[model samples]
Target: MTEDTSWVGPAMQQRVPWVKAVGITFGDVTARRVVAHLPDDPQLHNHVGGPHAAMIFGLGETASGAVGLAAFGSVMDRATPLVVSSEIAYHRLARGPLTAVAELTRPAEEVLAELAGGQRPEFTVTVGISDTDARETTRMVVRWTLRPNR
Candidate 1:
């Protein structure tokens, strides 16, 4: 199914403006992936004068969460998506504008099947943070759990 992600950024900023403080904005969303951008700004600088790690983590999670909703919204109407856990590895200091991209690792059918059986299911999305030069700066695996809204 096709979904319109054009409103994602504005809607997200309205829901969580703190994310906007760190310069997070939705870049693109497609059936295969969701991408977010974090501009290179001094406001996001660390004590050492580099991008803060926490902000980077937030950017990744935001992107992944957007992907989750777009990819599974139909089945997730009565379910709530929660971030169960995440693992991130920073390869180098972020020195430029950053882009976080999240893509599904398993087929959508598999995840929906579990939900159809009235079982809470978990899905993982791998978000890669890349610099303006397209160099990988960090990698994060965010595990999300979908539970009945009750």
Candidate 2:
């Protein structure tokens, strides 16, 4: 299967403007990169006037999901794809525009290819989100078990 052009990074950014409204976007993909951000927002504060953890999670989740979805199209049938699991960790408080970047470091893609050959295989994609200052506020590892059908 070929990649799903519709879910490309730019399109997702445009469609899901809400995320962009919150100031989160995808970063470098050829290799590991950090999430870039501006100063923190006081509006989304958690009493302490600092960025809320939920906001951080929201940013990380959407970014991770996009990477997985894009990769799914890259490897599987774009018609019907599979939904998998995602794991993430909050390393610190975020107070700026963030960058979420991901990479399929392992040979799991090979496993996914094998599984896609039969009953649809489950695979994982590791994603990381950090601030532009080179500080990492979140680390995530998302698994997407995909197939042509379900």
Instruction: Give every collision pair in model 2.
Output: 35-99, 36-99, 37-97, 38-97, 40-95
lDDT of 2 by residue, 102-136 (tens): 66544546755666567556555565666646577
The prediction achieving the highest lDDT against the true structure is 1
Model 1 reaches what TM-score against the true structure? Answer: 0.90
RMSD of 2: 4.3
lDDT of 2: 0.57
Where model 2 places Cα greater than 4 Å from the true spot, the runs are: 1-7, 14-21, 30-41, 74-83, 108-112
lDDT of each: 0.84, 0.57
